[model samples]
Target chain A: MQKIVPNISVDCVIFGFDFKQLNVLLVERKLQDEKTGETLIDDWTLTGYHIFEDEDFDTAAARILKGLSGLDNIYLEQFYAFGKVSRVDSPKDNIWLKHQHEGFSSRIVTVGYYSLIDNSTVTLQLQERNVKWFSITDLPELGFDHQEILNKALEKLRSKLRSEPIGFELLPEKFTLSQLQKLYEAILGTTYDRRNFRKKVLQMKYIIPLNEKQKAVKHKPAQLFIFSRDVYERTKRERFDFSI
Target chain B: MQKIVPNISVDCVIFGFDFKQLNVLLVERKLQDEKTGETLIDDWTLTGYHIFEDEDFDTAAARILKGLSGLDNIYLEQFYAFGKVSRVDSPKDNIWLKHQHEGFSSRIVTVGYYSLIDNSTVTLQLQERNVKWFSITDLPELGFDHQEILNKALEKLRSKLRSEPIGFELLPEKFTLSQLQKLYEAILGTTYDRRNFRKKVLQMKYIIPLNEKQKAVKHKPAQLFIFSRDVYERTKRERFDFSI
Candidate 1:
């Protein structure tokens, strides 16, 4: 008797900020069929992979990140598990479908994980076809239900931003209050009173003022601030509400 | 070229309270060997299933609960994803291996979900095997990493208990302050100051004192209280710190 097993995989939508817009890492589908000579070169999606029989889910996520982006020790969080049976389009008509076996179907259950990385530090090799970063707001139609996955990740990110100091991960090590406010505004997709935002952020005491200021902006250079890791660690143990 | 596809599955651990202790639903695993005519009887595990290729994970979870427990619309939440290779111990050296094909390997990734059900309303049937409720504290050695999954679910339960009005799910529709307090103590594993606990709960203003009292208690007949759903829904939308 053949034992039936469920296949598991992990997908990650890495988000970063370029001081103006939110961007996500995406890769073009590389697998193609030679017999029919068809390709899905334009269908881009998040970096994902199958969970090997022996690997743990978190380990599989880290391994996928390492394999695709060549980055390690990045903070990765499990967001949602996508288990809609037909999330992937049918392979029968898909050029990529010819690459798979006949009896097997595209029944993928993927756990979505999101990571925040500094885009400047990332060295894009384009090793896996057309791997690139696209503005999240202007993303093209994704291959699978990746657009939905990305939206869910953004919601998680917004909720996380309220309680945790995760926004720092999307910005540079040293940044200005305006930059921080802009990042929050972009993520929340709402306008905030600048004075109130600064006041609230200052009250949290998670950010420390640096002596340096932003140098290249056309307007008045804003004072730079760095996230106080020690302060964040200490305050995290205490219950503080940052709902607003 | 062979195309690789992933299979998806959902596993649920339903929890209930029996006034004295916390319990979890388990199903017996029946193993029979064709070669030696041997059988391993009464092996118990969580209720699980392979999600059809086109079903949503949440939908599959609801279906599994309805199929196994004949219950729906219960308080369910996703806890963790288990993707460890070799999670299922092979019985290759056992008598059952003789009936199975060689070089056959099964890799399964199971997402763990949990539901809080009223113990009194749980109607059990020996659908698959011997279904029984075991005290969570004294659960039998479960298959694979189910024990770990249960622990994570309990942690999530505890966290949700502090933030939401989930204790009502574990208790009767009408309950006393002491019963409510005991439920919290059981879930949190900590003894609370009786006066302080009552005061804090009262301050939340989401519990309504009913026009009745417990009749058969050993001590004073405590005033019955019911969670005010309207108040809870309203308060949940606002930011309230439940750190203490």
Candidate 2:
């Protein structure tokens, strides 16, 4: 067996958006209480694993998330490193850590990574009944410092969305401007003037206009648009225009 | 001695600006070779130490720099995690590690932190003839993966300066407008039109104008200003304006 690096692990905060609400993927662990002989709190955590010796940190993050999203090349951006000595607070957490690795402690520092993906298109392999999606606002009791990790991830995502055109990763190929505005509102936890938002974004040449519109909606269909990667990549080298 | 964490370390990229150029602190290690009975590369490395079992990563980073800077409250921001199997490629590194702790391997994950400080005020304590500052552009051969760590720290610093008002940390209590512009140009590696730069920044409410200018300059003196911390703190919660 490969000798895993002692006292180190990688955790990922995978964010998913369905054009309306933001969600994150979390894993539940099974641990037993010694006195009662009963299953303890099913603590939820960001899906992660101990990194192997051969791969770099980026590759290790992707390795933990390989078969879950169905898509192979997920962009995982490392944001922060959580290194509180007491991150794994309770006795139950230590038991869970033992379950993952014999003679283990979650005192390890975790390199935090986050990515936004389209929720409807990919197949989410939950791995038995453990992994599930919880609303960003309604998270359950988390294990370790995973809650702190999630908040930092959200802060990073908000900052990233303000600077880059990464918000397109969360939406479908073609989306209405209203849907785009709502996506930003969800992530930023704020409201925007629809007319002003439309005016500013419409002036940008990168958000290409599409021919199709919503088919089954009751109200009049708004025009669809797609983010132009060719222009985004080229102009990304030049200067930023689409900022919050 | 307290048990140091196995296979884990904290490295700091202590960036100091002396008005003209950016400099980083590095330490040189001396070790004799086993076979030829000669000294090795005299490798330069970031001033770092192994994490204590009970200490958090930030505390560990601050602890390493505290003795060197002679300042107890060294703010160390965790930026990146460097995890590579071959990070300690040279035989000399392994030998040095063994000297520090028996049965030591370089398969360690190092958490990277960078901090900016004004060079003139603080007295830097160089351990032996070992620690010294070199210009960021003119770095020499570094030990292990320190050069890579330095590069990553610079990248993070640039991005951070673009979004936040962190550039003030490098400046004195008060500075001329030209000094501020030069700081940006130095960090970004690009020149900005003087008139446009001043006009844009003067419009900002946070850059408070002071009743002072250059005292002993031969040329015409420029007016000085200070970044208002109250305004910066209040506005930091809002959207960002100072960006690239």
Candidate 3:
């Protein structure tokens, strides 16, 4: 076997939005201890893997994400590197990993990445016993400080959403203003004033109004709008302030 | 012997502002090849070290900075992880590290961090051969991927400056409005309208003016001011718009 690059692993925090709520992709693992030979079943973790010797850092992350989800062209961004000695070297991870894989006999430093995708666009073939999407609010204790990794990813997402229109990635091709508002509310966990929120949206010329409306709806059908990245690139105001 | 955590390192990108320009912290390295006995000298790199077992990632980074520069209270922030497999696997670096350090026989995944400090506040006793501050613009080609790491760190610093009061860290305890403006212009690499810049700054309640002036100066002295963190924390507006 090709010797794995020692002490380096890639973990991905995949954020999915299903219109009303936020979700994260997690993989379930089961292993036996190296020292005690005790078995571990159904332990949940963020989708992660060891980096191959010939791969770039980003390519390694993209490889794991594509292999598991079978999806491509997803927007992935590196958020942080977690290198606390015990992050993987703790007794629990040490024994579990040592027994399962020979290459994992030493301390491992993991690079953390967060990917954003619309939950409705892709289907997950692995579930129950393997991989699943967990709501951002509720999650089980993860293996090897993955909980902290997910927390940091969410923080980056929230901060990025405020300044840029990245939330459009978590949205559909065409969506109503209310649907767009709900997406932001779900991700940010805050309510916005309807008037001000619309004012902000209306001011953004890149959010092009399309001649489409929700079909077969019992309530009033709202007009749909699409995000024009070209327009946004040409006209976004990036004036930074030092009031703070 | 207590073994170092194998294949994981932390590199610090310390950015210092000396009123007129930006400077970065660097350390010189001298190593000999394990195979050919070829000696490499006068190569510059970021202050970095492998993480010690039983230490936190942030704590390890802090320890490295403190140990190298004797600066304990500097503001350090994790920016990214450079995990391209060949980042340290190039034959030149591989043999050099192998001969000098046992813990680095395998691959290295380096975490990059950037620290901000006022240049006037520091007293560098490290003379010619060990450590020194080089202006960010006039930096030589650094060893390994340190140049890429430094570029990434500056990108982060610029983005953070847009939304937060982090640039204050690069300024002295007391400074004139012109000095503060120059700091922003230098860091952002752009010029601003004097009236607009002053208006935006004067509108900030946190930028408090004092009855202080330059004791000795050739030109007319400008009034001095201080940044009030408490006022800023309580009153800063952080509404981000995307009208572009």
Candidate 4:
């Protein structure tokens, strides 16, 4: 029997980029009436579960992610902790909780974790559960304040993508400047001047240019660039200004 | 009687700038032997308490800050959540926990909140609890995992100070360039070239120079400047790069 911490839980918002738009991985939550054998409620929610009493939060989040996706060593980060008393106030959420646990607590504090994965790299083994990636702009009505959670996660992701080089996690190893521009545009929901964007990115010491070009494409082959994290760590100076 | 959540607690790392160095607010945790009435352990820890079930995390953090400082609307930010099972493994911490609550849970997940205050602007009202400000460099062995919590809070503060204009929170409304430079130096633990630093700051349009000058100083009266948050908010653009 798993000893669950009654008041604490963990939720993961896995983000993926497929070169066109930014999407979030969500799991379909379906609850059926025990006695009548009928579907009571069905909705979408982020992948999550109650943390075990003996496990730490990071371990719990990793365990849940691996169980859902069968992937390890992904880019995971803890963004925020949502502790509103009415977070699970929806009737359907309450019903689902009641069915899942006996005498569930009225309040739960959920720690939010977000992970990034390359859309084309690995196969997600989520076939058993109805898991799918939904575009951020066209998300369905998520269950139990998960919409707010997802929104917060997106906000964190946007702020982080602007400053950090974590966006490479969602892109292929060898990528073109256009693909990189598309990624920034997709996540930030804005367009950048191609000339100015390329100039700025090219000036960055960590963005190393490669000798190879795109192998197969309809358009003219573009030069590929690789992000050198080692060079970034070695040559990075203490940043004095953040108002980039 | 106060209703408390056994497993969820909030720890506050209150940072104050005294113009020379960074200091953290700590409460002296003195435990006395029950039968002998002799002081067994005396040490310092951050000001914190278990959150009430009725309120949210922000509300709980604010309430704790207000109760300790008798001040409201100070600059408070939630940085990280510490959920390690062995956070309170020390014998002194365990003894204090046993003295405070009946049958306390073995595991506690503490949300870390950090706040900044100008040391000269307001007087702290923590005399009853023996709370005092200790310099970050010169500190005693803190009880529990408070030292780790304080270090994380400082890391967050350092990171936030570089990218955001939050360093002004520790300065007086009217300050000279030297004072501003000193403020940054104290927090960042590094000295900036005077001419270069001034050049960078002057280029920022939001840092408005006032006609007023310093009064009653030994050296020549330097020009005064105020951080124009209104102008900063109005003219702020979406940042594209974070690598300063």
Per-residue lDDT of candidate 1, residues A20-41 (tens digit): 7888989876664457765544
Give stretches of model 2 more than 4 Å off. A1-3, A30-39, A98-101, A216-219, A237-244, B29-39, B91-103, B213-222, B240-244
User: What local lDDT score does residue B243 receive in model 2, on the 0 to 100 scale?
Assistant: 17
DockQ order of candidates, top first: 4, 3, 2, 1
Q: Per-model C-alpha lDDT, please?
A: 0.72, 0.79, 0.79, 0.86
**Candidate 4 lDDT for residue B103:** 56
Give the C-alpha interface root-mean-square deviation per candidate. Answer: 5.6, 5.1, 2.4, 2.7
Higher-ranked by lDDT: 3 or 4? 4
What DockQ do the predictions score, one after another? 0.26, 0.40, 0.51, 0.51
Which is superior by DockQ, 1 or 2? 2
Candidate 4: stretches off by over 4 Å = A31-40, A125-128, A203-205, A209-211, A242-244, B32-40, B203-205, B242-244
lDDT for each residue of candidate 1 in B1-244, tens digit (9 for 90 to 100): 2222233458898888877677899887666655787775336678877665456778778878898767778878887777676565555323222343332335556788888888876776656468889987788867656777888888777766655577788888888777777777777777778997788777766788889999987988989888878877776553423111
lDDT of 1 at B103: 25
Report how far residue B65 has shifted in candidate 1, in Å.
3.1
Give one digit per residue, the lDDT tens place, for model 4 in B1-244. Answer: 7688888989999888787888888899888888999997899999888888788999899999998878888888988888987888988887888787765688999999999888767766565678788989899879899999999999888877866888777878887787888788888899989998888888888899999999998988999999999988987787566451
Fnat across every predicted model, in order: 0.39, 0.39, 0.64, 0.52
lDDT for each residue of candidate 2 in A1-244, tens digit (9 for 90 to 100):
8656556778889998877789999888767777898987677888877777677888888877785665667878998888898887787776676766654554677889897788868757766747788889899988888899999999988877776788888888888899888888898888889998888788777888988888888999999999897876765552422110
TM-score of 3: 0.86
Ranking by TM-score: 4, 2, 3, 1
State which docking tier applies to candidate 4: medium
Clash totals for all candidate models: 9, 0, 2, 1
**Local distance difference test, candidate 2:** 0.79
